[model samples]
Target: MRRRGLAFIIVALMLGMLLAALDQTIVSTALPTIVSDLGGLEELSWVVTGYLLASTVSTPLWGKLGDQFGRKYLFVTAIVIFLVGSALCGLSSSMGQLIAYRSLQGLGGGGLMVLAQAIVGDVVSARERGKYQGWFGGVFAVASVVGPLLGGLFVDHLSWHWVFYINLPLGAVALFVIVAGLPNDKSQTRHRIDFAGVVLLGGATSCLVLLTTWGGTTYPWSDPVILGLAGAAVVLLVAWAVAERRAREPVLPLELFRLRAFTMSSAVGFVVGFAMFGALTYLPLYLQAVHGVTPTLSGLHLLPMMAGMLTMSIISGQIISRTGKYRYLPITGTAFATVGLLMLSMLTEHSSLWTMSVDLLVLGMGLGMTMQVLVIIVQNAVDFKDLGVATSGVTFFRSIGGAFGVATLGSVFSSRLNDDLSRVLARTRLPPGFDPAQVQQDPTAIQRLPPELAADFLHVYADAIATVFKVAAPIMLVAFALTWLIPQQQLRETTKAADLGEGLGATSAERSSLAEVERGLVRLADADLRRGFYARLGSLAGLDGIAPQGVWIIARLDGKGWVEAAELACRADVSRATGRPYVDQLVERGLVERSDDEDRLRLTGEGRVAAGRLTRSSLESLRGLVADWGDSPQLKRLCERITPELLGARADRPR
Candidate 1:
């Protein structure tokens, strides 16, 4: 496939991922409005909990299915299911209906998140994948910021129903783009679906989620229903383990745990998920119920955290890709997160939004450093055969942690709030008909209460949420400790498939040549080196005042003769919005000119001269880098022939 085609596919996948990740947070700000309209006050947490439960349970199953069938069709199918669920959710008339529809949406969401990573592993080399995975993190950050605001906008201006309705058009565009751009490679090997394993695992997960959701909320901790669910979960999980060990193909192969990298990555992922979701879920409530902010303002308040996450994620990805070192990043990240969570635990009703935002930013930085790197680590550790399962396993565990965190922390918050509210109401007189439950259910009800009662309610909520963070702080410490156990595995420069193929044949001398090429490839793949090389090339081209991006646009015009701005942006892996500024800058510099054909750009004579210099400088740099290799034509020929083949083999594999 051409570079342009691959870039388009990646964009489409990002959009699909955005659709799924956005849904996770978009409903959060709207939850109060949803409860008010649907009248499921006590059952409010179920709105998020239900979707998480279904998505978590289905994650590994979707990965296994994608591994068996082709990923393209499976991805498209997931998008379609998500869209249907989204439309149904918008049409829901009752809270129960909404919960059910959200679960249906989750069933498809599992695939959207996992398969996107899996497909990238299939296409890109491991060395180059870090930068691309950074884009995935960027998508999550963007979604985290946008989803809440969009949800708030919908709830505030349009009806909250538009939150779900908005997904329809986006999903439609993603579906069309993916079907058209993503290549399908049908699995040639026969695959046996692990029916028994899926059933046992699904049952076990459902029971665990139910236990967490209902424990100490709907039922006492010692209630027979909760006890029975807990017992059944343990039994079902054991059975699933047994089934996996004996099955022809397991949904989650037990063998993966044997790798320290895989085990540690999964463990860290779980704890990070617990801390991340637990805080994000409740922070909005703090803003609305305690600070009396509107939903829109609550969304805006989260921007600091999102900004921290985005910055650190990109920076860490670039460093990892450049240095090929990773174990310490997660460790440092967890430490930051621990400190942030500790700070958050100290918050009182008097705490300001700025203080909260700073704490969240610290937590976000910590999470950003840890989350995507762990996935990359696990993917690097596993073979191509296990890539899909391994990638999905990380997501699956993280999501499970999220479901447990929300339920368990919610229980803590509710219990503490209820006790505090009871104490406050016991000492003070209330309006005759007002129920204390209304304060717990509706933020609007707090506003209607007398000043003293409302202040008491705010204090109780603030304290309860603080207690939740206090509980989570220790878990972050544990995650930090677990990072130490992650064995320092050397990050692979080539995809697993490429590595396997190269080892299959060739003389000892040829192997030596390939080793040299591998080293060169690693240096070539360094994100910093690539950026510097491009920057140097631009300067050498006599376009020193122009930005690197503008030079890239000029180069593309020189190579392709004439292309539209949209095509240039796609090929350059930038948004059209971002590309326009570079194009305008280049036009102003007289390096590029508007073509005779409408909307196309072409290089001028000055641009051609600059392009010639850039080409010569780039070739000279490459030659200098390889100068140490003995001037053997045979060895040179082998290196040149094998490198592209290795890349092509990896890219062509039907992962």
Candidate 2:
């Protein structure tokens, strides 16, 4: 494909990915206003939890279906569902309606995220995959930073519904680009849909999440509803296991748990999601209700944490990509997260925003370190056949953990606030018509009370939030310990730390083994391509005087054996006059020879020898990058497969 056309396709994919990632965080700052407008504070966590649960459960299904049926149409279908869901969410009149719509949106969001990333592997060459993957990470970082602030802007200026409505225009643009720029898919794989496993797993997960969300706050722990949910969760879990064992393709293969690395990473990822999303869900409430910050200002105050996460995630990914050492990251990351949670638990109404910002930054740093590292650890440990499932499995656990975390932590916050409110109200008198229950359901009701009464209510709110973090701190400690249990496996060249973007975005795209390795090598080989990297490869190939452009011409000749001089110029997007100099340079260096008509060029024996040398040099560079994989025949074949692309034409340079 032409470079401009390919770029458009990538842009479309990134837009799709951005829409899904943005939704995850955008609703956090809006939740306070949403609760105020919708009048169902008890169901507040469900807003985020519903989306998380639906997206999590649907991810693997989307992945498998895209594999069975080509991705092009499926990608379009996902965008349509997401946009429809977004429109419905904007029109919702109640919290219940909104939650339901958000789940529908999540179902589409899961497909958008997975298919978008997977399409990159399909459309882009292996050598450029790493570079594009890095761009995807940037998209996530932008979403994480901007989502909350954008949500707040919409809510404070317009109605809270605008938060969902905002996706409409973005989704339309992405849909247009994807349909116009993407080619029809030609590949398909046959596989069972695992309907039984998906149904049982979804049933069990919904039951478990509801149990956590409702057990104490909505109903007493001993209530029949709560007990029934518990019993149902257990029975469904057993049935799901049985179904998975018998299914031809389980939604989550049970055998993955046997790999200690997969098990440990999944566990740690779960806790990380628990603490991260739980805090994201509540911190805005604390800022808005207790500190009296506007929703927009509340989003601004959360920047410290987002900054820490983006910075540390990029830094850790770079370190691992370069040095291939990551065992320490998760352990230290969990330690920081635990400390950060404890710090957050210490906040009271009197705590300054600066203090809170510092605490959030610490927690964000911890989360950043562990989130992507766990993905890498699992990818490295799994066998080739399990690579896709294993990677998605880790992500699944983290997402489910977030769902449970928000629900469970919200329950704790609600229970603690109820108890505190009862104790304080029993000893004090309230203004006429001011019901204590009103304050529990609507935090904004505190502002309507007298100054002294509002102070007491704010203190109760602060205590409840602090207790939420307190409950999460120990869970993070368990993740810290699990990091120790993750065996230290050598990082493969096929999987680079730079893929932290996919991990950060929490996508569930499953790549084949060859695709995975190609992505890592392309990232390493092309890391410095813009800064004369081709020239460096030329020098490595013993072509000392060749410019990067000359290197391009030689590689073109090497790949095609011969090329019409005018055709080469046209492919390079340059005039024949401008491109002739590079071809002349290769000819002068005896790496190419003119055809009898002098209108075409082909590599000479010397040129072929230089091309062979370049191939070996490129392979050696990749081999060194994955030295831990050893010099086996399998490694050689993989390197051979990758070298041509690495030393092939540079799309950005003159041929």
TM-score of each: 0.73, 0.92
Computed on alpha carbons, the lDDT of every model, listed in order, comes to: 0.72, 0.85
- Cα lDDT of candidate 2 equals 0.85
lDDT of 1 by residue, 1-655 (tens): 6768888888888888888888887887787677667776556666777778777677656766777777888989999989999999999989899989998998788678767756775665544655666566557666866777778788888887988998899889888988887777744334687889878987998798778777887799999999999999999999999999999877779999999989998898888878877776788777777887887788788777766766677677777767878889999999999999999999888998999999999998998788767766776787645665676676667776777777777777777777888898888788788788777767656766788768888788889889989999998999999999887676755321121101100000011123323433433544423444456666776667877666555555655577786776666666778677777887787778886554788888888777667656654554444444335464345444333322212222111
What's the CA error at residue 71 for candidate 2, in Å? 0.8
Please name the candidate that would achieve the greatest lDDT relative to the true structure: 2
Off by over 4 Å in 2: 528-551, 559-562, 570-582, 588-591, 595-599, 604-641, 651-655
- Give the top-scoring candidate (TM-score): 2
Model 1 clashing residue pairs (backbone): none
Q: Positional deviation of 654 in candidate 1, in angstroms?
A: 30
Q: For each predicted model, how many residue pairs clash, with residues at least 3 apart or on different chains?
A: 0, 1
What is candidate 2's lDDT per residue for 333-441, written digit by digit as tens?
Answer: 9999999999999999999999999999999999999898898999899876677678778888888889999999989988998889889999888778767777777
